[model samples]
Target: MNINGLEKTKTFSFDRSHSAKVLFKRPDKFREIEDLSKHNRTLINTGSNLSYSPLGFYKDSISVKLKKFNRIIDFNLKKKEITVESGITLSQLLNFTLLYDLWIPQLPGYPFITIGGAIASDAHGKSCALHGTIKNSIKEMTIFHIKNGWLSLSEKENKEIYNLTIGGIGLTGTIVNVTLKLEEFKNKNFITYKTKVNSVNECISEITKKSKEKDSFVYSWNMAENLKSLGKGFVFQNKINDDNVENFKFIPEEKKNKFLPFLPIWNKLTLKTANWIFYYLNNSSNHFQEDDFTSVIFPFYGKEAYFKFFGKKGFYESQLLISENTIEDFFDEFKFIYKKFNPTISLFSVKNMRGTQEFLRFEGNKICVTFDFINNKKNILFMSELDKICVKLKIIPSIIKDSRLSKKIVEQCYPEYSRFRDLINNYDKKRIYKSEISQRLEI
Candidate 1:
C-alpha cells in the first residue's frame, strides 16, 4: 500500500499536517489479508484525504485504502434499493442513479466523497430539512468485521451494529459495501424560490416554517459588519414538481471544470471583498435559478481542495451543531464571538435539522455554524478564542470539521459522547479503526 507521488505530492499545510506520518493508497489488485483485530492499528477513514485533523491523533497503524473495490453489486428497481462497493464515489452514484430516474435524496456538497465516509460522518445536505441526513436513506450495509468476517446489518439483523455503522465513523469495522434506499423521479424538475431576510432570527423563522410546510431544501447566508454578519442573505427553497415541461437536455454544459481554478494565491486579498459582494447579492436577490442536480449543489461544494484557495496558507473550518433549545442564545453568543475575534470568515451558512440516532450523530432543532479562516498565527489564535467561547457556551463542535477542540469540550457538547465511546470500546476494544480526531478525543 504505497502512496502515490509522495516525493511529488502536493503538500497541504494545515494545522494537522505535521501529524500525518503515512499517506497510504490502496492497491488495485484484490488481496485478502489475515485477521487484523489483534493489533492496535487504526485505518484511515478519509475518502479523499480532505479532513483537517492531525495524523497521530488516532492509532498509529498502517493506513489502508478501499479505492480499488469499485463495483455495483446489486440494485432492486422495484424496491428502489442499490448496493454498491465502498470505493464508489457520490458523483459516480449520482450519474448512475440519474440514468434510471432514481437518486439518493440527501447528497453531500462534495461529489468525490465515498458513500462509506458520508455514512460515517452522517453527512447532511441542503435538502435535509425534508429528507433528513444521509443516515435516513440507509436500508442495509455490509461491513468486514475482524473476528466475524463479513457481516450484513440492517434495522432487523444485527440491529445494534447497524445503528452504530450508520454514523459510526467506520470504527465498528471496514465498510466494504453499502445498500441505500433510493428516491424515484421520472423528471428532474424542481421549483426554486429565493428571498432575502433582514436578521438571523428572521431567516431562521422563515426557513423553519417554510421547510415544515413543504418538502423543501433551505440554506441561509450572512452579510453584516465585522464577523456578526448574520442573516443579511437569502433563503433558497426548492421542491420537486411534476408540472415543469422543460427538457433536461436544454440546460447548457458547464464550461469551467475543477472549481474555476481556485483563484490565484496573490488574489487572496480580494476574496473577502468579493465574498462580501457575493453575500450582499445573495441576500438581495429574490429570484431563483432553474438548475439540475449538479448545478444546484456541486458548484458551491466545499471540495476541489479548499486549502489551495488560501494561498501559501491553507484554511481551517470549525463547525458546531448547537441544540435547538439553545439556538437563539447560541447565535447571539456566536455573533459576540465573531465581533470579539474579528477573524476573516469566508463563507457562513445556517440550516435546520430534524434528528438522528447515530452515536455522535449531530441532530435536533439547531443551526450549523461553519467558520472558515486562513491558516495563520492570527487564524490559529482566533480558533483558540473560539474554543474558549464554545466551552463557556457549552457548544459542541462537529467532529468531522474541527478537531482542534479538546476532548473535554466534545464531552460537554455531545450528550451521547460517553455512549459513543462505550459502544466503540465494547466492539473494537483494541481500537483498530481510529483516526486522528478519535485519538485526540480518546474515543
Candidate 2:
C-alpha cells in the first residue's frame, strides 16, 4: 500500500512559517499507515498540508501525506448525509455535493483544506456562530492506530476517542475517513451588505448582532493603517437567500499561490495603499449585492495572491477567541499596541463565535480577532507582545494558527489543557501520531 514515498531534508509548511527536515511517506491505504507507524519515528498524518501551523510534520520525524486516500465512500441523499475519505478537500466535496442540491453547512474560509484537517482542528466556518464547527456535522470517524488497528468513533461508539479526536490537533491517531451528517442546501445566492464603520466597537457590534441570525454570515475587517483610524473598518453582513441573483457562473478552481519572493507586496506602503483601495472599493459598493455560495464560503479561493504577498519570508496569523467581556479591554489594549508597534497588517478580521469549548477547539460566545502580518522582527515582536496581552486577558489564542505559541501560554489559556494531555498520553503511550504543534506545545 505504500506505493510511493520519499524522504525530504526540509519542507516549508503551508503557512510558510516553519520548515523542517522530515522523513516523508505517501501511503495509499490503511495498512501502509499502520506498517509505517510500526517502523518510523513519531508520525503525523498530513492531508493537504494547508494548515497555517505545522500540523503535518515535525523536524526529523515521519510525515505521512494522505492524498491517495481521497475518495467518496458513500452518500445518502434522503438523509442528507455523506461518507468520505479524510484526505478529500472541501472543494472536492462541495463540487460533488452541489450537483445533488446538497452541501456541508460548515466550511472554513479556505476550501483547499482536507476533511481531516477540519475535523482535527474543529475549524469554524462562515456559519461559525450557528453550527459552531464541522464537528456538529460529523457523525462518525474511522481512525487507525498501531495498537487499535481501526476504530469507529462516534457519540455512541468509542465516545472518549470521539471527543478527543475533534480538535485534538492530530495527536490522537490517523483519521482514516469520516461520515458527515450533511445539510440539504439550495440557497446559492446571498444578499451581502458591506457597511463602513468608524470604530472597532461599531464593527464588532454589527458582527455580533448579525451572528444571531440563521441565514447570514458576518465578519469585520479592522484597519490598522493609522492611529486615528486604527480600528475603523468595514463589516460584511451576508444574508443567504433563495431569490434569483447574479453571481459567478462557476466556482474558481483552487490554485497554488504563486510566490513573489523577488517582489514582496506586503510592506507598509502596499498595506496602506491596499487598505485605502479595498476600504473604498467595498465601502463605495451598492448597499446590497448578490454573491454566490462560493464567494461567501471560500473567500480566498481566487484571491490566493493575498498569501503570495507575504513573499519568501511568509507571514504570521494570530487569532484569539475571547469573551465579549474581554473584548473591551482586548480592543483597547490591541489598539494601544497597534499605536506602539505600527506594524503593517496584511489582513485583520473579527467574527462572532458561539459554542462549547472543549479540548483545544476554538469556540464559545466569543469575538475572534485574526491578524496576518509579514514575518519580520517588528511584526514578530508585535505578535509576541500581543501573546503576552492575550495571556494577561486570559484570552484563548488559537493553538492551530500561531506557530510560535508556547506551552505555558496554552496551559494558562486552556483550563482543560492538562486533561487533554493526560487523555491522549494514556490513549497513545508511545505517541504514534505527532506533529511540530504537538511537540512544540508538549502534548
Candidate 3:
C-alpha cells in the first residue's frame, strides 16, 4: 500500500481495498460462476506489481485478489495444451512445464506475473518477432461474467470475448482460468553472441536480418552518454545445436557446494553511470551455454526481488511499439527528447515485434523501446513528456509497464478501445468492474 517518496491516501472514503495475506487465504473451492456476476463496488484486478508500466491503477473499486484460485486442472500432451487457474504465476508454470520439456512461447520481462495478468495485457518479450505475443500462445480462456455465467472462449468460439480478454485489461469480465498452447523444444543448446552497434537504426537492421534465421534472440541496450555506442549495448543471438564437452562449461563439485550471497546493487545513479560506461567501453562479446533447453527457455528463471535492484525508489518503465517504418523517426524523436529532458534513465532496451491478429495485440512490423526510470518526481515528469510525444505521433504505447500515462492516451493507443468498452458495458452495466484507468479512458 506504500510507494516511494510520496504519501497519498491508500484508501479513500468512496473507494474500497482488500489485501490477502499469503497462506491464510488459500481456498479449496470455486464458487458458482454467477456468484462473480455483480459486485456492489468497483474492482481493481492485481497479481504482482512487476509491471513498471500501468498494470495496477484503479479508482473507486475494491481490489480483487486471485491467488486463492491457483491450480492446474488439466493438461493434454498430444494437444500441447494446459489448463490452469488464473492466479498461477509464470514462475510456477515454468517450473511445472519443465517436467514435460514444454515452455510458454512468450514471456515478459518479469517472471512473477500471473498467467491471467499476462493475458490481460497481452504480454510479450525479446523473441516476439519470431514467436508472437502471449495472446498467440493462448489456446483458450474461461471468464466468469455477470450475465453470461462461466464462458469458455477461443478464436473459434466467442471470438470477441476471447480477443477482448487477451489484452483486454480485465475490463470485460473476471478471468478465472486459462488454457495455453505449449511448445516442445529439441533440448538443443543456444549459442549466445554479444555485439555492439553504433546507432538505433543499425541495431534494428541487424535484428531484422538475424530474426529471419528462425532461431535468434536479441536484447539491445541504448546508450545515453557516449555517442559512439549510442544505440549499441549487447546482443544475445542464440542458435540451437548439439552440445559436446568442449561446447559446455562444467560446474565443479567444489563450486557446486559453495553458497555466496548475491549482493543487491543497481540504483538510479549507478545504473545510469553504468550505461554511460558501457557506451564508452563500446565492446560486446559474451557467451554462455545451458546443457538443456528447459534452463535456457526460462532465461531469467527465478523469483524476482526487484526492490533490490531499484532500492527504496523502486523503478518505473515505459514501453512503446512503433511501426518498423517509423524506427528511424522514432529514434530521432528520442534523441531530441533525451537531450532536452536529460532525465536519469537507468536503461533502455529494444526488441523487434512480429504482428498478431488479436484485437488488442501491440504488434505490427514494430520495434519495442522500453525505458527504465527510477520512481521520482522528475522521472514522472519526463514520462509525461514522453507520453505526450507518443500520443502526438500516434504510436501505440504498451500500457503494461507505464504507470503514468493518462487514460485518454491509452484510449488513443488501441484502435479496438471502443469495442472493448462496449463489451465491458454488456457485462457490467453498473460499472461494477471499474478502475481509475477505465474511468479516465472512459472504457
Candidate 4:
C-alpha cells in the first residue's frame, strides 16, 4: 500500500542503491499473532523509517509498517510510567508527557524515531553517561512471536528474551507495545554550558571530567574543516531545570521554507561550506545559555538544511565505541585514516558513554564517535578500513548505524556474537522475522 502518495516500492536510505517493497499495516490489520506467525513469507517491522542502515530494508521480505499502531494505551502518574503502542514516535511521547510534567530521560537527537525502533537498537542519548540506553527506561514490552504467540517480557519476567530484544534489531519478533519509566520534571527548560577543546585528547579528557561530575547530559562535536585540526570542537553539558518557570516554550517547529531541494552534484561542496560556517558560529558563541530541554534534545530537527548534504546517493554513518584504555590509540589511528582518505564527512560527533552489561552492548566506559559520509565506493572502502582498525583496537561499531559491516567484523568485534546467533536460532526457529541487516550480519 502507498503511504503519503509515495510508491509502494521505495528507497529508504540516502544511498540510492538500496530499496525495498513496503507494506503498510494498521494495528487492527493483524487480528491475531498467528496470522503473521503462520505466514509463509519473512517479515520485518518498520516505523518512521529513520534508520541510517538497511536494518529495515529487505528485498524478498514483506516490511510491516507500524505507523497506524501509534497510540497511548495508558499512563500511570503515580508510578511515572506510560504504556504506549510501539509505533508511537518519541515526539508524540514527549508532547504527551510534557503536559503531565513527566519526561523520558533517554532521547535520541531525532524526535521522529519510534519507541519500538529506539528499543530495538537500544539507542542512547547525550545523557547516556547518566541514564544509559533506552533499554534502561523500558519497564516491559509485549512482543508477538510466530511460535510463542504474545509474550510479555521484562527484567523480572522472561529476562533473557527481554535483554536480547533490547538490541535485537527486531529480529526476534515484532514489538507491539511497551511500558516505559518516565522522570518527573518541574520545568521543560535546561541550563546548558559549552566548553571548547583544542584536540581529540583534550575532548576525551573533558568528557571524562564531566562524567565524573555526573552531568545530566554530555556530548561533543568536532567542528574542524581539515585534518590539521580534526578534533578542535566544543563540549556541551546540560541539566534539567529544577524550578517551574512561567511561559516556558517547547522546542521550535521546523519551517519548510528554510530548506532547498538538494542537488546531488553540489552536495560535497555544500556540506563543507556548511560545516565551516557551523564551526565559526559555534566557536564564537562558546558561553553558558538557558534553553528549553526540547531544544537541546532535538537540535537536528530544527534545521532541515543538513538533509541536503546527503544528496540523492544518501550517506553512511559509522559509530564506534572505543574503550577508555585504548581511546588514545584509536584516535591516533583514526586521524591517520581520516588524513589518508579525506572522505566527504558531513557530520562528526562524540559522546561519553558508560557501557551497559547487555550481551550486545559496547562494553566498558568509552567514548562513542560517529562519522557521517556521503555514500560512494571510495567512502565505502574507507569505512571498511576503519572497521578493520576498530577490530584491531577491540572497539565495537554500532550495528544500528552500520550498513556494510561484514559477518567477520561483527564476529570479531562482538564476543557475544555466537551467543546472540544461538539465541535467535533457538527462539525464531522458523526464521519468520527477518531484515536485510540480520541477513547480512547473520544475526
Candidate order by TM-score, decreasing, is: 2, 4, 1, 3
Query: Each candidate: what lDDT?
Result: 0.66, 0.82, 0.64, 0.77
How well does each candidate superpose onto the true structure, as a TM-score? 0.85, 0.95, 0.81, 0.91
The TM-score between candidate 2 and the true structure equals 0.95
Determine which window of 10 residues in candidate 4 has minimal summed lDDT. 250-259
Using lDDT as the yardstick, the better of models 3 and 4 is 4
Best by lDDT: 2
Tens-place lDDT per residue, model 3, 233-273, is: 66556666546323222211111212333333665467657
Lowest lDDT block of 10, candidate 2: 245-254
RMSD of each: 4.0, 2.3, 6.5, 2.9
Over 4 Å off, model 1: 1-19, 23-30, 33-42, 52-59, 224-229, 241-269, 280-286, 301-307, 388-394
- Better lDDT candidate (2, 3): 2
lDDT of candidate 4 over 23-105, digit per residue (tens): 53444555643465444568787777777777665876666667877889999999999999998888888888888888887
Model 1 superposed RMSD (Cα): 4.0
Q: Write the per-residue lDDT of candidate 2 for residues 45-77, one digit (tens) a residue.
A: 777787888998887568777778889999998
Q: In model 3, where do residues sit more than 4 Å from their true spots?
A: 1-27, 32-39, 54-59, 226-229, 244-269, 276-311, 357-360
Q: Write the residue-wise lDDT of candidate 1 on 1-443 in tens digits.
A: 32232111222323333344464535344333233433334564445544454422233544555677667999888899999987787877777777788888777776676787788778778877677788888988888766567789999899988888776766777777889999876667676777777787888777777778666778776654464445666777776656775654322222235444444352334655776777676656658766565656554453444445665445677877666567787777667666766666666677776665346776555666666766667667877877766677666677677656678877876778898899878877666776666777888
Q: Which of 1 and 4 is the better model by lDDT?
A: 4
TM-score of 3: 0.81
